[model samples]
Target: MFALNRKNSTFNFKKADFPKLYDLLSKVDWSEMTNVKEVNAACDFFYNTLECIFEACVPKTSISKISRRSYPVWFDSTIINCLKHKARVLKKFRMYQCQRHLDEFKKLRSQAKFLIAKGYSEYVKSMEDTISHDPRKFWTFIQTKRGKSRIPGTIFVNGEAISDPCIIVNNFADYFKSVYTVSLDNNYSANMTTNNNILLPKISEDDILRQLREL
Candidate 1:
């Protein structure tokens, strides 16, 4: 879990703070700290008190889950604002069916739809162009959109709930191994030989080698 403690972790200083800081420092009795026979205790108290004062002045901080892909590249703030205005207009129109309000809402709704479609088309075009120049980025964008947001806490294998990480990995390994493992005595290699009786033309190995060299 991510934690943010604004009071202690951050100092949002403003011009107004200079006066407050000065006053705070002035109110502290430096002589009393000096009178403490032990140097470490006096230093600790002085610094701790100063820290507390600073924390008292700063604004409270708020923390939330880190947003993943909060907004797509083609999202237009102008269009969003227009939509919001249209929603308000719609509510007013519904309350009192004035032709002016109804017409305005209809026009705004059509405009929003058109702009949204245009944005989507442009976004797709940009992605296609990016795929040609940088395939890694194109795939990354797709993965971020399609990727699972949460990992399964437990996996069910053979009608049993399995939660151990190592067990889960081993189960997948065993499954894939069984699926791909070839039979040693299947005579699969014999089928790869070319049949001379076939009517189709067969290019010689030398011809293929010569073509590769030409490239």
Candidate 2:
């Protein structure tokens, strides 16, 4: 099992007073920035002022999330509550070595296991039933089971195996450049010049109104 930790930040825009922010911005003395002689100083003042205004209007919040790879996808409220109950039973059994507590723990453990298996089987059956109509979903489930894909350590270029990352990237860039490069010839250039020389017909307001009426 692996755990991945990430931090996400978002602004509370729903609670923000955008009208007040606009009024505040409109009242700001932007001429204060003009007093700064250096371009960097002026930019710093401008950014700082706006940052203070935004901080007051729309506060930001940071949340930390931890994801576990061992967590099952078929987990639901019923399964979760059963598992929690089983854990509590096991804890009571451990604290008090009573035969009744031990038996209860064992029973709950078996029930939890059964519920997990049943949930997993039902999820698989649903996927199987929808496979013909939604193959993409089936394939996505397959991919999740297979886990993340890794880039190849070596690549073939011009019938030669290359292991250097820089060389492989350069080869890809060169190949794409060749594929997308446009070739210019005398004939193409002459055609472009002739097309540029062709004049478009002029249309008056009356003609535009007539076309709109027809539409």
Candidate 3:
């Protein structure tokens, strides 16, 4: 079960009174910060004043912990609309208890199921078709479904499990150094000096603009 669990604090910036906020900010004596010699104290005073003004002008809302199931990449807006319509139909059937509403609800329910299955099938087919050429897309989709970071919580070295982040990092550095370290023979050093003496062509502004346009 892949789920996301977190809480966030947000403010409705769209609903804020910009005029009042601007007026309050303009009224603040910013010159007072200049009198403070320490840069940290000046920054603290500025931040506190802005925070107070923001709190007075805008309301803060806290989002409760959200535990949501991960949806597939194939779940598009069409499927969303179908599900919403199905829900509305079900609500109508329950409220009216009419035969017509019940029939409509059943029809929509079947349609929604069919659409979902078809979407998944198409998604799988596309992945299979492109796996040979673009395997990254397939792996990226798998990672999305996993809904967790790729970083591991523990690393093992020489059959001993190490969980300390600093030790794990040092182990990685040592392993990489062992793998990449190269012996500097006299010939290799001479070849490197020769390569360093070779100058490459300079790139112009037009070349950069052309590259940006292609991107």
Q: Find the candidate with the highest TM-score and give its number.
A: 1
* lDDT, candidate 1, 1-215, per-residue tens: 22234534345555236667778877877787877889888977777777766766554334454545355556688767777789899999999999999999999999988988898788767776665456676666666666642344578997999988778888888989989967664444454454434355889977765664453
lDDT of 3 by residue, 11-70 (tens): 557778899999999999999998999998998888788777877887767777653544
| Model 2 lDDT per residue over 163-208, tens place | 8877877888898998895878888788888787755699897786
Q: Give candidates' CA RMSD values in order.
A: 11.1, 18.1, 13.7
Tell me model 2's lDDT, rounded to 2 decimals.
0.76
> Cα lDDT for residue 103, model 3?
94
The TM-scores of all predictions, comma-separated, are 0.46, 0.43, 0.40
Each model's lDDT comes to 0.70, 0.76, 0.79
lDDT against true structure, model 1: 0.70
Model 1 residue 41 lDDT score: 87
Which 10 consecutive residues of model 1 have the lowest summed lDDT? 1-10
Models ranked on lDDT: 3, 2, 1
Clashing pairs in 3: none
Clash numbers, per candidate:
0, 0, 0
Error of 1 at 85 (Å): 1.8
